[model samples]
Target: MNDVMWKRSLALFAVALLLVLGGCGQLTNSSSTASTGTTSNRKVQTTGNYSTTGYNSVVTEGHYKTSAARGVAADYANNALDVKGMETGLMQLSQDVFSPNKYTFQEGQYISAANVKNWLGRKSKSNATGLNPEANGSTDPDKRVPEYLGTMVEQDYMTGSGSKLSLGGISIALGMNAVDYYQKEQYGATFQTKVNKDKQLQEGKTMAQEIVDRLRAKNNVGNVPIFVTIYSLAEQDSLVSGSFIAKATATGKTIDKWDSVDQQSGVLPTVNNQKPINSADATAFNNFKTQVQNFFPNLSGVTASVHYLDGALTQMTVNIQTQFYGQTEIMSFTNYVASVANKLLPGNAPIQIIVSSVNTTQALITRNSGEKEFTTNVLQNY
Candidate 1:
């Protein structure tokens, strides 16, 4: 692929990656039938891959479009960010002398470079000027059982030493339709506009379970290390959607944000001074305990209190404390993860942590309110 075509190919990859866990409300009821009509091919799956026939998917049913991977066309491969990719990306992102080789694309029915380049989507929006990936049923697809993940996500935290693919750089901006592929196929824009919600949710659940399993294998494999993970996505009562991968840390410091009506005062920070918190962070803290057992001659179980300051700014504050322990290199660990995260995926994306015998107290201001400010205080270890 030449620079232009190769650029577009990369752009298409970006389009395929901005996937959210949008789909049917819940599969709890019998009346909620699948919006996707997978009967056409009889042997196709929806993962926004090459098989998708729907708007953003390949599977089609009724008037609503589903997954492009499940759709009729077949040029795209499965999510490169799949478990396979995540593992590889993490490994790659861990290098001191970062010498990343050109990553090869997963095998899909090969489409010509020209086709990918000039490919404008099926239809077009009038009076608009841009390029988009066309729906030219050009490539054939791979038919195989996907390599799945295990049941624990926290265990899959990309820690230790390895390099990984950073998903949100130019890769995300273009492939996800931010730069426009051909015409109406600015695919990223079409997700919410075209893809089915039920399918996305189902995919999310499957992916979630797989992520959990892998995480457990990675972190817990060697004597149950304290594994930390940040669980993101929308959750309320029994209904939850969307999913995310976050840094695993031993610092269980989180600020809960509630209310959507106002940003100025609806969100606030909370400090957890109690033991046993979110599972991911708790595990991370435990692992830290093992690592630091030899230090802080006088260490006792302490807690980081997280409380929200119900006010105009939506923030979370954590009060770090310890019952028994010594000086911790908190900044060093945080920096290391931040560095790895930057190398793998570049952006302002937040990283979560689970802490042990140290009190890491601070207010995380989430809202982009004007120019940001910072303040720090030195406290006694005792």
Candidate 2:
């Protein structure tokens, strides 16, 4: 047989296998329903829930979370920082920074401001100066202390020799009211804008120094290395772009030296060196879509896109459009599409399959050996 005819036969064989595996419920359901004579634009929505049955524990829903954080980091590093990106970046960074070392903290081993004081054998006196000790007469007992987002003792594999060094790190979310005010003021015709920006940065530096000092007082941290990260929030409580604002390190002996937000170094490492999808990959993806359409004639259209990181495919998304009668048909079609794509796709990267109709949409995500299945309603016109 010619190549075209051979591909057709293979497509038909795959569809027959799908129909058999889909069972009587799907066939009966599909046969009973007729198309409503109305044509409406389909809106696509996606929701996901993960299952970690047999895959490596490291690759989980966290991968998507990290991906999002990386996107935010890229925005900041490239000077495209915006309110939404800033907020998202900080929130995701908070989750990403502590996740890898979660298991290290035992039941009561987590770090806290109060506990750190006790660990240093210091008295439990509240800071009368509140978050900013430099502001005179601002000693309101109700003033908020540095909100500790998270803290953990991480092992420094890169810096330690022979035995790994226990590195203690603290994450804090700080208010950006001063910075926001300065940003708005800096736009004015007055020369104070530059002054205000400088003052705000100085205040940020001071706050960071105070935090480090409190954590290191009287050798509280002993010989372990302590790292502190301050994430600043704008007036609306959203994260400020390029607002990794302050980072300080102390060795429990000398004073902590704080640095202004280093635009180049503050970005999370995972986001660096990402590779864009190439022409060759695009061709391969197009071929895969053609094969899928041949295997599933009911599909009205099929679209595919690939996501890459450091010259390797990290994710592939396939959207299948069709007219479906009910949930049974949707499930059957989704399963069939996922199975076919899983076989055709290369590498162990995650695959996202989105199946949509006029009024409903479903998403099936597979990563490594695990799978996440969820569905959503299409409420708006596309």
Candidate 3:
């Protein structure tokens, strides 16, 4: 594969990695009924790698879409972290209903790069299916209006095993801008179009319904369960990520009921020295942060993004920034951080600790749910 194709494959894998959970092969009632007019007596089987939860995934090896990966960079927030979070976060949410054990995962096939560009554009005489409001020929930075519907991500789930798998369900994530930042001219003053949480949620829901109507027109979508979620993208400069506000399942061509998602994300060690969300996990992370920073005082900073689902800690990603460049020093620090993480951090949820210098990643340590120790890797310079 070429570089572009390789990167796209990696992006899809990253999204799938987040959906990994612990179990195998039993399809949920909703999932079993999600078939796209395909019938088979074959029981669901694992044709791919197993998740941390021991659940085997039905792998779709050659079904990646190159445009979907580019969409993350072009349509989502400018920050790489935000882009990664939004895509992976959507898959994590989809796993709640379409378990990885039962559904074969694949990158979105229906929406293309041109389709995303058109839908994000303002509604105009030439663009009839635009999801954003018309520009109205405003020149002022504030009056021109920033786009609210930033990006749309689609994840397709399939049921059954082997070559006979069919569409089990589909997930659509709307990445909306909570704060739309724009400049009047090149290298000029930048202004923000702030939309409150309430308004963002409302606007996202409206867009979700519209998107579902458009998808229903597609021949492949059929009557399979379509899960539509609304995510509020964080500011471009934020170290933390945005959260999913609400999600609903569209059984027919339209969504009938919407349910609020109690999902949230926060920066570790408390930003502005504010109180932490879950005291136990917060305390553990703070202690781990202090120990690692103290061990290597040259460390620039240690921060984390903790994710919660239904008020319970589900995942934590820690980023350790340092200035040291020596190979031995990084190796020692990576080991020490791994030990501290294994000792201090909560073990009930998945944790990923990354050690970096300047902008390059130096080492990585990860521990899956229910695991006592973390697996560490120190990257080698070429």
lDDT of each: 0.24, 0.37, 0.71
What is the per-residue lDDT of model 3 for residues 286-332, given as tens digits with 9 covering 90 to 100?
79878887778886667677889898887887777677889999999
User: lDDT score of model 3?
Assistant: 0.71
lDDT of 2 by residue, 337-369 (tens): 666665565545555455555334443434442
Question: What tens digits encode model 1's per-residue C-alpha lDDT throughout 1-382?
Answer: 2445323332332222222101221111222122232343443222221110011212222232222221222233123222222222222221211121222111111222332322223224541211331234422112211111111111111111112211111000011111111223454332112223333333334333332343234422332222222212221110111222332311112212211111111100112343432333344434443444334333332122111112221111111223433344544433433333233321222222222332332111121113222222222334
**184, model 3: CA deviation in Å?**
3.6
- Indicate the residue-level lDDT of 196 in model 1: 30
| RMSD of every prediction | 23.7, 18.3, 8.0
The Cα error of candidate 3 at residue 31, in Å, is 23
Model 3 stretches astray by more than 4 angstroms: 1-73, 137-146, 185-188
Q: Which ten residues in a row have the lowest lDDT in candidate 2?
A: 50-59
Candidate that beats the other on TM-score, 1 or 3, i.e. the better one: 3
In Å, residue 348's CA in model 1 sits off its true spot by 24
Question: Which candidate leads the pack in TM-score?
Answer: 3
Sort all candidates by TM-score, best to worst: 3, 2, 1
TM-score of each: 0.18, 0.35, 0.80
Candidate 3 matches the true fold with a TM-score of 0.80
